[model samples]
Target: MTVILNQSFTGISIGAVLLLIALGLTLTFGQMGVINMAHGEFIMAGAYTTYVLQKSISSAGISLLVALPLAFLVAGAMGALLEWLLIRRLYTRPLDTLLVTWGVSLMLQQLARDVFGAPNVQTHAPDLLTGNMSVAGVTLANNRLFILGLALLCALTLTLILRLTPLGRRIRAVVQNRDLAEVSGIATERVDRTTFFIGSGLAGVAGVALTLVGPIGPTMGTNYIVDAFLVVVVGGVAQLKGSVITAFALGVLQSVLEYSTTVSVAKVIVLVAIVAFLQWRPQGLYTLRTRSLV
Candidate 1:
């Protein structure tokens, strides 16, 4: 029972990380219909932002806290710039966006290598997050717990922004029907850029949380990009609730499978399961209901 509980917590923590990574893709790819292969680089940028702040500041905790908002702005600005310079021109051509962003991703990786060098870097987590706590015979890592809370908080904040804010309403309007939204006097282009900013910013936040649990490096984002996309696709594009549910479900399943099998084998099993599930329901766990003719 104790082992089961521990694994479950671990799964939940993993799910939190997935949720953070996928949340941005949900906005960019899922809602906007742009295959941003460079999205992972945005995560890398956030992680590097944390690293840079830590180098300048003596306190790990202060640096981390500062990194959160700074990373978001840095990544969000990059996303907005990308949209203005290239993605905007190819919004109607997803394949072009994919190829272009893939090239951009490679460029970003090379840039990181040039700037930070080829060696992986490590961040020092604060003492508060370096310890472990036991709850009912289950040991919980403070870092993981912090990550879980941060993920939940981010999800909730995003949900509120989408559902209740004027900007979100504009974004939804543009997404549902760009032509109609423009006809209705909404600045669809600006909305698109703003949406991209928020989405990419979320990826930055995910990157910051990740520094607590893993090594930082130029190629680190590549390791999780596919899994993040899987979470978004399986959850259903544009369906926040579906992404949330799918993230945790896959996490638990992966954790359980990894306990009995090798990590590679566990990943293979999960991929197979996702493939089977998608074959049965390719629209994913949820479908968007839009009134637009297009």
Candidate 2:
């Protein structure tokens, strides 16, 4: 029983990270209809940013916290610049967007390799996050708990912004009907820029949280991108609720599979399941409203 609870707890923690990573991807791909292959690399950039803050700065604690926003800013700036330079030209062209973003991803990965080298670096969990607690004899890592809560909070905040705020409403409008939104005098360009910011910023924050749990490498995002995409795809493109449900389902399912079989086999099984689901629901599970958003 204890072991089962521990495993479930760990799976939930992983699900949270997937939620963050996929939520961003969901917006870019599902809502914005842009396949940002560089999305994963943005996460790598965030992890590296966290490393620099925690290792090189004088106050690791404060510095680490500061790195969170800095990571978001840096990634968002890069995302914005990318959108301005390349993505803007390729918008509405799905295949072209993929190719261009693929190039960008490769470039960023190589750049990270050049600057940070091939070796992986570990970021320390702060003292506040280093401890663990027991739940019915199931010891759970504190940092994992913190990450899970942080992820949930971020998800909720993002949902609220999209559901309540003017900017979010406009974004949703543009997402549903680009021509109509533009005709209505919505600043699609600014919204595009801001969307990139939010997407990249989410990656940045995910990077920081990830750094606390694993080794940071220039290409670390590669380890996560596929699964994150799967979560986004299965969750349905723009539906936050769908992303949350699918991410957690996949996470826990993957964990359960791992327990029952080898890790490699489990992943293959999970991938197959997702592929089958996509084949059945190519439009995704939670379709965003095309009309009546206003």
Best candidate (score: lDDT): 1
Instruction: For candidate 2, write residues 186-293 as lDDT tens digits.
Output: 999889889888988899889988988899987888889888988877888766889899888888888888888978998999989988998898767787655564
TM-score against native, each model: 0.96, 0.94
Runs in model 2 deviating more than 4 A are 289-294
For model 2, give the 10-residue run with minimal summed lDDT: 285-294
Q: Which prediction has the highest TM-score against the true structure?
A: 1
- Overall lDDT per candidate, in order of appearance: 0.90, 0.85
Superpose all Cα atoms of candidate 1 onto the true structure and report the RMSD in Å to 1 decimal.
Answer: 1.4
Residue 23 alpha-carbon offset, candidate 2, angstroms: 1.4
Model 1 bad stretches (over 4 Å): 290-294
Tens-digit lDDT track for model 1 on 1-294?
998999899999999999999889888886568988888999999999999999999899999999999999999998999989899999788778989998999999999999999898999999999999999999999999999999999889988988999998887777666788999999888888999999999989999999999999999899889999899889987568888999999999999999989789999999999999999878689866766554
